[model samples]
Target: MATGAESGRRLRVGLLGTGGVASKYAALYGEYPRSLLVALHDPFDPGAGELAARFGGRVAASVEDLIASDIDAVVISTPNPLHLAQASAALKAGRHVLLQKPMTVTLAQAEELERVAEDSGKVLALYMNSLDNPVFRDLRRMITEGVLGKVGSINCKLANGMGHVWRNRPANFWRGSRAAVGGGSFAMLACHYLNLAQWLLDQPIIRTTAIGTNLMCDHIEGDDLMSAIVEFAGGELGVIEAAWCVKGEQMSLHGSAGSFAYIDNSVVTMKADSPFIGEAIRYETPGTRVVLDGLLAPAMSDWTNPYNQHRCFVDAMLDGTPVPMPAGKGVQDMRVLDAAYRSSAGAVHVAVHVAIHVADDGAVAEAVA
Candidate 1:
């Protein structure tokens, strides 16, 4: 464990999987001078070699070889099923881990990885990058600053046509396998909003009722359309709708003082009283462009949400600071996801068995059933 003060040299990083997601991280890694991608590993030799060539790193022969290298951290971008084993291996080998979303396909795996991370005394973070979105961060700040004034409800919808493309692909499409990726749209895409809902509301979902179906993209094993209604402990009601059939994105928050809506990543805010004085205002900044700019840039920019997230993770490891998205958060998110799936499968409202208690010191204590 090298502290920022102890080591002025760049932190060496090993990429555990050379998939599409891995390539994105590799590009980001190239942007940070304080971090260097030193090794790449994947079962596919060509994929690993491609990423290594593009990112200026050597291809390791195997996962074992990559973890055994002198890298200080490992970014696990493999499929959901492999997350637990790879992350656990990295942590046990005395290296930090940056695991991709959904953490694992099961709560048991997530819990085990959480425990392993805790025992290792190493940083284990989930790649829930949406939290780093500038609009989301600003919205959270506004709500915290009382601009929203007691949020009562939240609605989020993300419908894209990716399912059409995915279904036509080969049967080996890792995401199409429920056994490999957990759930479908809910797990793959909606889970991001689930995390955002909790983050923006600052509350844990106490109960949830969900309905999911593989209405379209029948070739896939999981649901392509899913909707979940959740009740927060603070009395805030949330509605989340996700589908691979439709094509658009929007989120809105309703509060006592005012309301805010985010459509396609732009924000429109309105206040309670406005005699044409303080009318609704819209801020226009394409979210996709922001993310793309971050990805295309030569250096990491704190202004870009995703890059900022990776930068935070690197800083946490080097400075011995707290991780922005810890493994516990991933576990909790997985619990909500599992509850949604159970609720949908049983055709009933499932009680979220997790109890979140805020201690006097402001530390959160979670007990999951």
Candidate 2:
């Protein structure tokens, strides 16, 4: 571990997958003087070579070879199913991990990895960079400052036409296959909002009823659309919608004294029965400020961007700070997702039964359902 005094030292970083998302992460390494891309690994040799050439890293022959290398951290951008095994191996090898989202496909897998990370005493951060959105940061502040007084409900929707784009394309067909990607649109997309909901509201979803279906795009076995109604422990209602068939994104939060809505890139707030009553204040984040590819791309601005997320992880390793998004949060999100799926399949509302306990050493443990 690099000491806090050795701030000039760079953390040797290895890439576990050379895919599109991995390339994006690699591109941002130059922005942080403390992060160095030292090695790359992928089963696809050609792809690994290509990324290594573009990103200034040597192509390792295998995951084992990469783990055994002198790297302080490994960014696992591999597929959903491989996350558990690769991240576990890296942690056990005494390497900190920066894992891509969804953490793992199932709650069991997430729990097992969490235990491994705890035992290894290495930083295990799930990449949910959407939390870095400035708009979200501002809204969280508003809530904390009581600007949105007594918040009651939140409705969020995220949709894109990607379902149509990948409908019959063989290259993108794997994304639609449940066997390869795990769950459907919810796993691919909704998980982002789910994580955000918990972060912004600072509440855990206690109950959920959901429905998912592949209403379009017959080429894939997974659902193309999903909707869920969830109740938070704090008595807040949340309605979440995610799809690859729609065209835009929107989110709104209702409170007893005020309301906040974020549609596309615009944020509007109205305070009820106050001086701002009937007057909606609006703030528009520039188009460039929006992360076009969501968490998959680098942020154009400096405020709470993906680059900041990476920088924070690097700093935590060197400074002994807490990870921004720990594996425990990922497990909690996955458990909620598990409840959503079970509710959808059983046609009944399912209660989320997971509990997160933080040990004295800052290790996180989850109680089984």
Which candidate number would show the highest TM-score if scored against the true structure? 1
Residue pairs with colliding backbones in model 1 are none
- For model 1, the superposed segments whose C-alpha errors exceed 4 Å read 1-7, 45-47, 267-307, 349-369
In model 2, the runs with Cα more than 4 Å from the true position are 5-7, 44-51, 265-307, 348-369
Clashes of each: 0, 0
Worst 10 residues of 1 by lDDT: 288-297
Cα lDDT for residue 109, candidate 1 = 89
Per-residue lDDT of candidate 2, residues 158-240 (tens digit) = 88868888855775556777866667888878888899999899999999989998887667767788899999989999999
